[model samples]
Target: MFGVLVVRLPEGRLGFLRAFSGMLAGRWDVEGYVPPLFDREARASLEPQGEATVKALFARAEAMRASPELLTLRAAHAEQSARHASEIVALRERHEVRRKQRHARRAELTEAASKSSTPEASAHAAELRDSLHALDQESRGDKAERRRLEATHASERSSLEPKLLRLERRLRALDRLRHMVSRAVMRRIHDTYVITNARGERRLLRSLYERAQPPSGAADCAAPKLLAYAQAHGLRPVALAEFWWGAPPPSGGRVTGAYYAACRDKCGPLLPFMLDGLFVARPRTFTPPSTTPGSLSILFEDRWLVVVAKPHGLLSVPGREASLSDSVLTRLKARYPDATGPLLVHRLDLDTSGLLVAALDARTHSALQRQFVHREVHKRYVAWVDGIVTGEQGRIDFPMRVDLDDRPRQIHDPIHGKPAVTEWRVIERRGDRTRVAFFPLTGRTHQLRVHAAHPLGLGAPIVGDRLYGRDGERLMLHAESLTLLHPGTGERVTFDSPVPF
Candidate 1:
């Protein structure tokens, strides 16, 4: 069996050897790792004054906004706009009230005429109708007079219009100037060629930014920086990986050791150039020869629902590839062909083995899903992480958002992230490894793993978590227990699964 291995190289393309003992053999180099965000050099380089030219550009923009003429123009525009708004509101209200009154009188007269029948009553109604017609003419005349007055008022205030337009034009010009300077500073600071080893094959930073169209601070993330360092050092990227270190940034979602994919909006475009000459392996896609019947463990079942234990490495539902069609739902469907509604109410990560509650009908599925969304469902996971725990128990409150540069992988974003919280209690400590129970209050992607690894949370990456930590046989995380309200009985129900690790 192949075991985990690490190889180090000074620089160059990875070498491959074929037909080795009936298997392909290859010597591959890792894409390279980037130091944590808080690395001393990285932090120092981020100082605002690191580039004097950029600093000066920003200062110049600020100075432009402080000009005397611009300030006067701004104040004058604000006053004129406010005064005009008040006058317009008054004029509109007066006209609207008069129009409504006229319409109401017309309606009342029409209704009375519709009800009249006797000769005398009809004659009187006819007279009243004539009067109403006369009133309608007068109302029309009133509307025309109102419009003329409004037109005159507008003409009287026409002087301010040109001044306002001129002021707007000037303000827009100033804004454009400021924007240009800011863009230049950002380009100088963020768009500089950092990845040197791309064999000059990679696109320039500015070109990448233009193509990717990422958010303001996206290009400066650790992934692209790490790739830049590797290229500069003449290292050929074989495989790339990143991890979170330090306390969760002001926002939350990152765990200390969980592996995360490169961001999409930020790193997606840049990585293609970085990996230009690398021979990366295509991801494997295959189905096992067979699965034993006992592999589909059923903990609880009834007419409406079934709580099945999902084995690790097995998908909860069919994957994108038809070759990966064998899954818990597909297997269950073979046995219970009549099962209706959404078969699975909630899902566990493909790597996480757990007790999954599946609903047999649509109503039951919707009910269970509602409970999950409202945070009424409770979940607990057991994990063995690569660190010793000093704290007895604590809660991790971190905001999480999908990193635009790296898709699927989440990041800590304080300004624009959803709140994620997890509570943990240490089960035991074994030298460098610590076992803990995780109580996730919010269901975010990789919530438990991040909480376990983020410095602010547990400060330890989970053992065997290939994504967040070192590679191993499997991630040492298990969904130990789940608690939810039963869809059928409306009673609180909890299920437990023995931790495999």
Candidate 2:
């Protein structure tokens, strides 16, 4: 028989080995590898907890608003108001009938007197006039009585309104208090937990909670929960990946299996601490271009304004990273050194190749921007979608908002979303893909892309759209044309770019 040796490795040594493995995987690992909430019961129970708490508070507020005493008071007020309204209606109806009767009698008497000049007829007419005068006095009394009744009704409503208002204010205060408590609870949850860095250093939860405002759904994210689980279990943290599963969210940027970097505001500080012990590899640096930016093709140019055709993969302007500092704006500025003011008037997504206009001077820029703000400028795009279109043409009206989980991604949110509209026409169908022309009525971010992909909209994701569709060589979307009034000549000018598939 052979004796077996059992060994428990030191924490430092184990951490080092894990770090080395993490570093090796880090080059291609852009997304968080947190395990998804696969348990239905767990996800269902966890998500509704906060919502249920808030709803319970709201129910309590409703109860307070409808307290026994308040309910009684409201019921009494409603009864009195109904009674007063009915009385007023009856009184007016009676007075109107009487007045009409008197007027008819007076008219008959006057006509009889006019036909006959006899003293007897005149005397009868005078007697009728006396009766008419009495009727007039009665009508005046009715008016005064109506006025008194109105005053009484007003006084009653005034008395009841204050009590109702007091109750309403109390309910509102309770709501505010409930919201405050909820926020405090959320903050505590975000602050009490701990996150371990790649280097295996654990830090307080609040240290990683830095942001101008907490990122959307910060308390409910899976990354923190996954890390907490790893720490609790004796598991080594190696690589992190988080992907969106289920139906794509509103903005259509999220696709299944697509890797996304951690959000700057939400996961920026937290990821650093979480990856502390691991040997995290740096992202490959993108080299700036040395050649004359040939991708920026000038479409139209004048003394005050210029329009340029921007190719895919080139930024409209310099990005935050120094490597991405070279862009269309930079190249144009370099070419026209004498151009004044901010040259680029508008922007296009780096992934979308399109026509963009710029102003050479400040005044022209202001005028051109005004046109955009007033919706005088027109923009059109062409794209190939993943599915065939059954309809020849249609319109999409979907409201959009930034996704709380993913910053760059947008979701359909009718309540909080800005209005976005797009009109689309099928141009051609090549096998499974359909080429479409898009007319954007409202220039919301990702308006055309979302409109094409959203289930409620077109239900066809753009071909080569990594965010909304399957990953491909490129995003098959192009800004085909732009039409705007020239600020200097006061003439409408249209710029066109050939669609590049």
Candidate 3:
């Protein structure tokens, strides 16, 4: 990604800083671009040493694999194996022919003995039986010969194996050494990164990722480079924007010239640390989906389960962070202290308001979860899209995957994406907006939201979608109703929540 930061000088003059995410055309220090967050001199020395050793090791391994002595031994063994197999087959075929001939002769002798009517018939039969015994002895001799041939071949083949095995062992050792050397080099390279926050607090880049190895190009994202430079140079950042400027990978869904959010994997951890001293006001704050906030809107409850009209901005389950402890699951756990099993059966997007189900016991939870997994549960979502949809009803089938760059944002990717299907029908068309109901056939993260916003789907962003389109008072989407089989009663049940826009 490429980024530009609108900056304010100490003298109150305005200027902008430009930065690219990582190396542009294999050069880290471009003429006018801000430098990366690493020690250049340290890398200059460390990278070459590691690269040279890795290359040399690879070259040696490749040479050893193609050595003539090894190849010749392998060829000799293969050729001998084929010859032995052919010889054994020929010997078996000959024995088979001899056995068939002996059988035909015995049949002819038996027929002649049966036709004879006198004493010669009995004597002839005895002679024929004796001949059959001789043939059985010949068959045993052939079997012995076949076993002897196989043993000889095995002994001959073993002769060349010791040399071949020794050569391969050397190659395997080289591969292990190469891997160790490469890992050592990368570890040192990570150590060279010295990242700083706005508070001027310094830390190693790898430290931000904790025990995990920082992903490749960890401190090299456009956000970090721009913010880090601004912090270092005493420039105050007023505004920032990042956009894709080049061809995206074939498996990627990024569009050239399209603005993008900061990548979560590389920048998610770094940005929070870097923006420590900045008063970064979020574009929008969580607003209640209904008239009330922090109060549970229990739609239905029974001995086995409970369904709540989850307000928007409330997480379906408690978040990992301590700050995000307020959620539907947390509230339920507080109320039903004796509730057994994981209370949550399914989840809704944090910004989506809708009917959410929770089982009071483990058996109910398991059964309810099965309904969702098998697509037996039905959900209806009410949404007001920014654009007036042209059709009355249609199914949107855009396969989706999480945008690796941005958390919680999805992109259309048929190749490396899960299937997300939505059946929708227009309820009302209001000037430039359309109110619609969406029935999702599959449950994925941000499924309904993405199906509404993606160009391949409805070609319209849900009104007030901050991530997909523009920010507003709240995301104009709600889980209006949910239908599922009651685990306790063995009957179908439906729950409804008023659509709050």
Most accurate candidate by TM-score = 2
User: 1-501 in candidate 1: lDDT tens per residue?
Assistant: 111112224644353211101111232122232322123454346545545644665566567568676677667667866776786687679767877887888888778877888778968777887978887787788678767766766775575566656756765676676577656555554544444335576454556656434456454555555555555545555555555554454434444545555556666666676666666567444453344323879999998899888887777888887777878888889877998876988777666777888888888889889988999999989999888977889999988777665455566677787999999999998888999999988889877876776666777878866545565666788888999989789789899999988
Between candidates 1 and 3, the one scoring higher on lDDT is: 3
Alpha-carbon runs more than 4 Å astray in model 3? 8-12, 18-239, 243-261, 264-294
lDDT of 3 by residue, 25-61 (tens): 9988788889988888898899998999999999999
Worst 10 residues of 3 by lDDT: 285-294
Better of 1 and 2 by TM-score: 2
User: Each prediction's Cα RMSD?
Assistant: 9.7, 11.6, 10.6
Clashes of each: 28, 23, 1
Point out where model 1 deviates above 4 Å.
Answer: 1-176, 185-294
lDDT by residue for model 2 (1-501), tens: 001111123363332111111122333122433232123354455446766787789899989877997788778878987898899989889988988987887788677767876769767777777877887898798889889989988998898878877887888898998888677655554444445554557665565665424554442344554554455455555555555555664446655555565555666666666656656678645443343334688888889988889887788889888878878899889988999999988888767888989899999999999998888988889999999888999989979987776555677888989988888899999999999999988888777778888887788888877666776777799999899999999889888999877
Candidate 2 global CA lDDT score: 0.72
Note the Cα lDDT for every prediction shown: 0.68, 0.72, 0.84
Of the candidates shown, which would achieve the greatest lDDT relative to the real structure?
3
Better-scoring candidate (TM-score), 2 or 3: 2
| Number of residue pairs clashing in candidate 3, backbone atoms closer than 3 angstroms, sequence gap of 3 or more or interchain | 1
Please report how far candidate 2 places residue 236 from its true position, in Å: 2.8
Q: Give the RMSD in angstroms, all C-alphas superposed, for model 2.
A: 11.6
Using TM-score, rank the candidates from best to worst.
Answer: 2, 1, 3
Model 1, global lDDT: 0.68
